[model samples]
Target: MVNSWWRRSARALAIALLLSFAAPALAADDAADEVGYQFSTDWTGPHTAVWLRHLARFMKKPDIHGLEIGCFEGRSSIWFMERIATHESSTMSCIDVFTDAIEARFDNNIEVAGFSDRMKKHKGYSQDVLRKLDYASFDFIYIDGCHLASCVLTDAVLAWDLLKPGGMIIFDDYVWALEKAKTQRPKVAIDAFMTVYANHIRVRERGYQVIIEKLAPRSDRELVGKPVVHSEEWEKDYEKKKKD
Candidate 1:
């Protein structure tokens, strides 16, 4: 009788121990299903979602590097982190001046997005935080900071210098925002870069975004001394078509 009781007690203990370990594994699986390994954010609209899905497909290989500029509150940064975590070998680098460097033009938008506290947590977007990251070294770059033409241009140039050969660079907000001044927006800078670098760069599936692979070493050409004639013609034609 005592042997029977002992056997039952041992079985109960073994079952409890197995369950304790299994619970966490089950919970982790559930969490993975909830978020998958993809990057997601409340700010991701239809275009952005489609673009990210396409990017994920393009990056199916094992040894891609990534970089992100203007990591405001880490929504996109966290997405990159998730991607890196899932891959056995991948790295990302981020850059930003962080503290209203261009102008506090979007203060209300940032606040409304509920990123004020999150932004404060990361040393206000200094490159120092990125310098010591333990993950894989960056092979691709994303630029989304300082929408002013000069600032955007500067950031792109700096990122270009850091970008590896065959790596890709992504820019945010390539479309015009009516509320912001037309002259110095992010799209303006991207357009300027694309016009000169069109030979080496290609537009990604995302209409506003572009992807460039560093094929051969290249130099930054001076911004065209004159306004782009092609853009004016295209814009004029677009407006005319719209009116009709």
Candidate 2:
């Protein structure tokens, strides 16, 4: 089991390394690359193409309703529109807190990609936009919002409420670092989310991007073999929240 963990880590690291070198080589005129220079953006990092491929495999069907928490320059949004939400009835919603030129670029990029009418753009912090959404209405959700531990955990819980049964939620930047080794960034929050919700969902893939499928209603036996982390401190926290 330890060897398996090491093997997955090694493979993830190798893919990360390869992404940096190969990102610039993706065909510019191809269908996937025609949506501006999103792939080249510094905010995208190296493993974007890999993430898109993963989304394709899991969300290949067209006409699905989707949500993206942080659209940034719309790289991942366009990827979803082009790859998975291709049917006329399909659409995606994006939420972001704008800064500088990113919002304008995000708009232009998705528009140029012919998704202007197909997407709903919400400008604000994720929490606000999420609150207005109908619960359990989304088929897929991609969360790349704030990196703070509490914020990420909040987004995860909210996304859980919005995700339909059998839907998938893809979390970006699971291992992001804010200040070398000082700040825990997204990992701490993601870890807490996984631990708290262990019985509610099934992990589909785990690496830089954590993907999980919300389980349909089932018997407790479904979670019989799943490992869980329990701590008295956490139990106290949970009880407090339950009372509130």
Candidate 3:
């Protein structure tokens, strides 16, 4: 038994290392690149193309629906539309507090990609826009909005309730360090969400992006195994500690 476990762990590690090195090369062949979507910047394409391309094979369906919190220049949005949401019935909704120029560019890019009719643009803050969206209506969601910890946490929690069972969510810039304080970044919030919701979702990848698939409904709070202590026991302990 011990030998089998060790062998399995070693094989998993080897596969992870191989993919880490090979993904960048594979991304070059992604079909989205051939569309020539107009972009003011290329922040997400290189890091996300390999995974998104892989997902397209399994996730592309006629009735697919996608949501994105940030759609800067429609780079990732176009990729999702052209690659993953390829069917005529497929649709994508994007939420971003857009400036006039940015919105114009995004509009033009989506038009060029022939997704203007199928795309829904929400011009507002994600927290507000997310609340208004229909629950469990999305099969795929990409979260790359405000990088602040608070915003990321809010998005994750709300988005969880909206994700259909077996649906996937991708949180971008997990290792970003532009902010001086560690508490201000997305990783902290992503870690907290993953820890609390560990029983509800299966983590698919953990790199620049944190990808997860919903295994159960968010309303299902059942833990998978025995917890260290029940809530009643924890409450009693807390009261005792306060007296001590």
Candidate 4:
């Protein structure tokens, strides 16, 4: 079992390394360049030319739905609205505390970009807002809410249930260091989540941002004599078993 785990880890690492080199080329989108977006900060720019563009190629469908955990000034949110969520049926939802007059700027940016009609703004903590969202409804989920490991883990776990099968989840700032302790960083929580869901997801990119694509539902269910389960159901059952 240990050897098998090592093999899988090595394979995943190899793929990640290869993807890193090809990421820039794969992310090139001519249409995305056509948009005249407005943003005060450049935090999300470093990522846009790479994995974000690559993601747009695969997940940009007519009915694509996206959720963002931390939207500051609508920088990354605007990218999704203009790039991936281009279809009339496509929609984007953002969760943020909107402190420090950030929401006004976010709102203005979205409005200026002509994406106000397609966006849903949830002004609250991610932990609270994510709970109220629909499960398995989002084709893409971007987590950049809190920098702490505990908060990051909570966001990832909650977001997993909200993501549809084959959906993509992007965790930002995997290597960020606001706290001195390693346990306080987002990498620790992201690594833990990845380790737990290793069998259920495919790691697509590993850099400043970590991207994973959901392969199967985390809960279990059965249909037409076939045994199947979604991850959310499995989590509930696990909790119930623990209680019993």
Candidate 5:
């Protein structure tokens, strides 16, 4: 009986040591899986997927506050909600004009694309209202609504103001290709903002999005420069292989 008891205690000690060594790695793997799975649900397409993988690595640290400008059907919003819910200490807010703000531009195409119903369902700011009572305030903001330059610019400014210091502001569709020949693309607005506020900005995954740590006062010297473009060496190689 004494021998059996000694062996049981030894087994328990061994298990404890194993857990002490493995816990951190297990936690890291879970965090990585969370990022991959969450991003996959929000972003599709090859380029966006690639960008998201890198962005996930950057966001391993938990964000205290979060925001999303376009909460279409709440796919991305749901992702943020999960993050906030799990962390218990984080907050997220979302905004959307929801009903196709640029009806004249993508009306026919949007229907053909089968996004009409989805757009219609996004008509209200219900998610944001619900979240206000559900979670804490946001520390990160994501802008994905109103692709038009003017509207995007306005949202960007508002998001900047809303972001807390050390918070991140993310702009979706910042590098979108526009159909209008006369109107400038949304990138123009993003570039204009970055041109004046480059120091606070960091290009994530080759400029698919911009991450700003906080909003700061702009200066003439800062305004005079242009937006910094991230090198696309890997992307170029990938494209070349696809062509080949």
Candidate 6:
């Protein structure tokens, strides 16, 4: 068993060294350059590019593991694999509800990019697959499945379970405009999750996408899900703080 593990580890290291040379620099000349990838996808193109750059910092490190919810045309997934390729032990799992043309594009892009071995693709709604994932196993997770507040919150809560200490979670489309209801946006769900884990949450970026890091959780405590703050309580607390 020890020899087998060592051989596997050694093989992973060799693969990582080779991939490091193949991944591109996170920055793109233009947001539209996503077309340069096997599949083209953009949500706030310039911001997405910048967001990728921020992720680059964490991904460049060794032995990183990642999970992504929603692999539309494999755009962000491609970027992620590029960085993961740099580290031998790095691997990523992506969950997507594959149907119709998007399925082919996702498969083709990942295949053509030479990442078939480094990535594991899960075909299903993120909620179901997330339940089966090991706790605190991923170094990074990107949530982009459904834009609805309930769906986004569900993904965040579950992803929280899978994220490792000092791991990062990227919530895409935070400010995406869908109708006029603020509650309908990703920000609503992301903020609610933030309130639940306020002490452990570190905000990294807030714009078209929100990237935040999860600080190590204490062995003695647990977060019970959504924050306890209601509008009335929050206002009262804020007002009290101001008067004091």
- Each prediction's RMSD over C-alphas, in Å, is 14.1, 14.0, 14.6, 15.9, 18.1, 13.4
lDDT for each of the candidates? Answer: 0.53, 0.75, 0.80, 0.80, 0.51, 0.76
Task: Give the deviation of candidate 2 from the true structure as CA RMSD.
Answer: 14.0
What TM-score, over all chains together, does every model reach? 0.52, 0.69, 0.74, 0.73, 0.49, 0.72
- Runs of candidate 4 exceeding 4 Å displacement: 1-38, 58-60, 218-244
lDDT of 2 by residue, 59-152 (tens): 5465588999988888777767766676778889999997768887787777666779999999999988898898778888888888777778
Task: Give model 2's TM-score versus the native structure.
Answer: 0.69
What tens-digit string does per-residue lDDT give for candidate 3 at 200-234?
Answer: 78998887888898898544443333445568989
Which stretches of candidate 6 lie above 4 Å from their native place?
Answer: 1-40, 218-244
lDDT of 1 by residue, 34-139 (tens): 3222122334332345545546643545655566667554445445534432254544444556455322422333333333433323333423544444332446
Off by over 4 Å in 5: 1-63, 83-85, 99-137, 182-184, 215-244
Candidate 4: the clashing residue pairs are 218-230, 218-231, 219-229, 219-230, 219-231, 220-229, 220-230, 221-228, 221-229
**Error in Å for residue 150 of model 5:** 0.4
Clashing pairs in 2: none
Per-residue error for 42 in candidate 2, Å, reads 5.3
Best by TM-score: 3
TM-score of 1: 0.52
- The Cα RMSD of model 5 versus the native structure comes to 18.1
lDDT of each residue in 105-186, candidate 4, tens digit only: 7886687567788999999999999999998899889999888899999999999889998899999999887456976789
Residue lDDT tens for model 5, 160-220 = 6455555566667666685664245677888787776676655543366655555443454
